[model samples]
Target: MEIRLAGIKEFSVADGPGIRTVIFTQGCKNRCKGCHNISTWDLNGGYIQEINSLISYIDSICPNKKVTISGGEPLIQYNELKYLLKVLYKKNIIYAYIQATI
Candidate 1:
């Protein structure tokens, strides 16, 4: 299965520990008062991203770094996040963080 994504940010230090890969999944139920990416709330707002391709992209990045799943609410697409975490866990990268609003 695939998830809709607003965008992906690579090598971000603010996301978590060390340089990180940040995946911004699309769609959100919460309309925050001061959301940075306020444009992403629409349920059908972003492009569909293949899970395999995203994993491959993450694989291509330097390991031993952090990975973050931010939103537009990552829990909105829990399956993909769960699957991605499984892959990251197997690779011994335990620093995957999630930034979402409920």
Candidate 2:
């Protein structure tokens, strides 16, 4: 599946429990007050990426670390994200986190 993304941080310490690779997906329904990623709220604002390429990139950069899926509300693209999570699960990657509002 293809995933729309705002950006990807190869390394992050604040996203989750440990050092993690943060995947910032594009598109969010919420426009909460004090939102920091306002630019990512548009559904068509970010580049599309293939799920495999994303996983491969993560593997190449840093594997076995936590992977945080943030937004633009990561759940906005639920199907794609679900598939991505499934693949990650099948690969024995257990440390995945999703940051979403509601």
Task: Pick the TM-score winner.
Answer: 2
Candidate 2, residue 89: Cα displacement in angstroms equals: 1.1
lDDT of 2 by residue, 1-102 (tens): 899999999779888887789999999889999999999999999999999988878777766556888999888888999999988788766778998888
Report the lDDT tens digits of candidate 1 across residue range 1-102: 788999999888888778888888899989889889887898899899888788778878855557888889889888887887888788776677989777
Model 1 global lDDT (CA atoms, 0 to 1): 0.83
TM-score of each: 0.89, 0.94
* Collision pairs in model 2: none
Query: In model 1, where is the ten-residue run with the lowest total lDDT?
Result: 57-66
Poorest 10 consecutive residues of model 2 by lDDT?
Answer: 57-66
- TM-score for candidate 2, please give it: 0.94
lDDT of model 1 at residue 28? 93
